[model samples]
Target: MGKSERNITNWKQYNQALVNRGSVTFWLDEAAVNAWHCTKHHGGRGRGFQFSDTAIETALMLKGIFKLSLRATEGFINSLFQLMKIPLIAPDYSCISKRAKRRCCLNKRNLFRFP
Candidate 1:
């Protein structure tokens, strides 16, 4: 095939997929909400925390989805918990930052990769 004649065979499908990318979605199920509670950090100097790894991880996921700062993520999560009537505590920005550093590095490609 000539250079000008060579093009993506599925260009229309690709365009549709690109347009659908804007409809981002995030969900926290009932089971997850029930499991979202503070757990004791073994061997840590301080007392047990009020937000478990699940909560932190969830907030991190939303942070990427919503393109929010750490503090904003915390607030957003807190609001969501309140709105859902889930009596769970939200992690502060500093707590999120510290825990996030210990948990994993930021890899936008891995988190935001489509399909």
Candidate 2:
């Protein structure tokens, strides 16, 4: 039995391919941008939420997808925003954690469903 080996003939294309593998393309639609901030007031005693549910869900989704810690997730999102030149701010790690717990409760009650 013999094993076949492959060799790179063009270093330019190979290097380009490697660079492209690390590139990530992301964009936020206008509707998503509009829904990023909380508009409705809960009329609570303390301060109201700045970011909407959509934002929190987005952060949590990214966290799970990237397998990143809460703080790392926050930085990742903020960096994405910076790259996109968007003025939006990422939700704090603590806020994401709290919302994640709440979302778990809602899921247990079958109140939240993902499509």
Candidate 3:
């Protein structure tokens, strides 16, 4: 009503207040870095070598963001993410979802067979 920046005098502090990621050390472990590197390079083939650091972060962001549904979140990541800013190693939603589904610890498929 009064000024365009009214009530938001300390925007920097306010923005910083929302940045509660716990810690970066645990998230960026050596194993994670190695995995990123391997994924980026396509297991040393150098096919996806152009991948950047942001790509991995973006992918992870998507997993957490769309925790309930793999389809929606991955679609968003693929379409909205800036390819140039992220690494080429980043895979589409389908790829991630398929891997997740396969790895899921679901009930044994044949355990309940009635035959």
* TM-score of candidate 3 versus the correct structure, residues matched by position: 0.32
Query: Which clashing pairs does model 3 show?
Result: 51-87, 51-88, 52-87
CA lDDT, candidate 1, residue 45: 88
lDDT of 3 at 97: 47
lDDT of 2 by residue, 1-115 (tens): 6765978899999999999988767687888788999998868788888888888888877777677899999999999889888899899999988977765333434544654
Report the Cα lDDT for candidate 3. 0.46
Candidate 3 residue-wise lDDT, 4-102, digit = tens: 665877988978766754432223334443555434344545345333444434454556644525566556554443533444234555655444443
- Candidate 2, residue 52: Cα displacement in angstroms equals 0.3
Q: On a 0 to 1 TM-score scale, where does candidate 1 land against the true structure? A: 0.65
RMSD of each: 6.2, 5.6, 12.0
Which candidate achieves the best TM-score against the true structure? 2
Query: Candidate 1 residues 64-103, lDDT tens each?
Result: 8789999899888888878777787678899888877777
